[model samples]
Target: MTATMMTPAQLARFEARLLAERADAEERLAEFDGVMTEVRIARTDATADDEHDPEGPTMTQEWSQRSAVLADVRAELADVDRAIARIANGSYGVCTNCGKRITVARLDARPTAELCIDCARQAR
Candidate 1:
């Protein structure tokens, strides 16, 4: 394989890792959905009064925290999906910013990465 291209074995490994990440994110999102549903039902109770109860976090706070977690998981799933698409288009191991081959070590650590270490650090 050329320097810019990943070997077939490396491609397969990265693809599998990305797919697993996607699955985990999807599962977490589903769990969050179920918990959010329960929270919504609890909020509808006429005498619950969680806001003034002072036992723990209020229902609104729980809902907001869960929503933020759900959003992060959804973003992770999107990134994984994009990485998979890049694999299909023969650009999986190339950095989007510098157009260089992303190091195998970096990809092994973060299969959904879109930038090389240098470009990524520069962005930060």
Candidate 2:
């Protein structure tokens, strides 16, 4: 693995931040899973026209939103895991797409980022 440009303090901070975010993401994923399961069960056992209910979002709509959130959280957790692995291998501050040092500000804002600003802009 390539040497990281980040100082030990910076690396430690980023690692801490990523770990915290990963924990939050995992919690959210679990919460979403529980809510999704509940909605599924409720919809399955419903005798009324839940699909056309006017009181609130239908079970299908709630499920869709929860599933989307769960997917995003899962992806974020994966990114955090990858970032932690990079940190362990001494490549945490290197941009995966461009082989350049990722800016400190960018890293501070998103500790799990793998691409530099240019690469990320291009990716979008």
Which candidate should be chosen as best, given lDDT against the real structure?
A: 1
**Candidate 2 Cα misplacement greater than 4 A, ranges:** 47-57
lDDT per residue for candidate 1 within 1-124, as digits (tens), equals 3245778998999888888888899999899989988887777662365446553457678778888998999999999999999999898889998789899999988888999999999999
lDDT of 2 by residue, 74-124 (tens): 888899999999999998989898789888999888888899899999999
Clashing residue pairs in candidate 2, if any? none
Compared with the true structure, all predictions reach lDDT values of 0.85, 0.84
Specify the poorest-scoring 10-residue window by lDDT in model 1: 46-55
Q: Report clashes for each candidate as comma-separated counts.
A: 0, 0
Model 2 scores a TM of: 0.86
Query: Which residue segments of model 1 deviate by more than 4 Å?
Result: 1-4, 46-57
TM-scores for every candidate against the unseen true structure: 0.86, 0.86
Against the hidden true structure, what lDDT does model 2 obtain? 0.84
